[model samples]
Target: MIADSEIELHASRLMVMQAAWKHERGEDIRHESSICKVFVAEAVNRIIDRAVQMCGALGVSADTPLEHFYREARAFRIYDGPSEVHRMVIARDVLRSGNRS
Candidate 1:
């Protein structure tokens, strides 16, 4: 049983994958999609951070993929509406739903 932190990271990746599938199928996942985007973006950064830690000095070096991943993950949040904005939207939806259970 691999109980590494990456397992949670994979759950984030799966959220994105499910969102993509829903989009491809023309399903309306707007509010939920924003939540997934926020989750995945944050998760990618966490996963990359763990990778960098595991690789030690090589992680930050230009010669390793860890460096590339770290660099790219920084832009993911910005390109797709940013996590803050998405979280706000999610919160708005929850409040609007009025199903506070």
Candidate 2:
């Protein structure tokens, strides 16, 4: 699970960076932005959780870096915009595109 989450998070970061560069070059990348946001937001939590699970008691300890990551990842889900909203936006865009084609 940890490996999968790491892979997913990396992919999301790459997507976001690419989108940002595209926007800097005067391209519209709203869909990529939302997709990356949702992907990273969800994957970060999963990675932390898997790490926590692997660490056992130490994972939940107040002094551990894993715990801090866990908290941050959980809170990140709600920052800027929630995962639910981003997913909805992506779904709506997909539906619109499907209808067009």
Winner by lDDT: 2
Which residue runs of candidate 1 sit more than 4 Å off their true CA positions?
17-26
All candidates' lDDT scores?
0.81, 0.83
Give per-residue CA lDDT, model 1, range 1-101, as digits (tens).
Answer: 22455687678778878878988999878976888888778777887888898888998999788998999899888777988999898888889987622
Tell me the lDDT of model 2 at 12.
80
Per TM-score, the best of the predicted structures is 2
Report the C-alpha lDDT of model 2 over 14-40, residue by residue, as the tens digit.
888998898999987888888878888
Name the lDDT value of residue 2 in candidate 1: 27
Give the per-residue Cα lDDT of candidate 1 at 33. 84
Candidate 2, 88: how far from true, in Å?
1.3
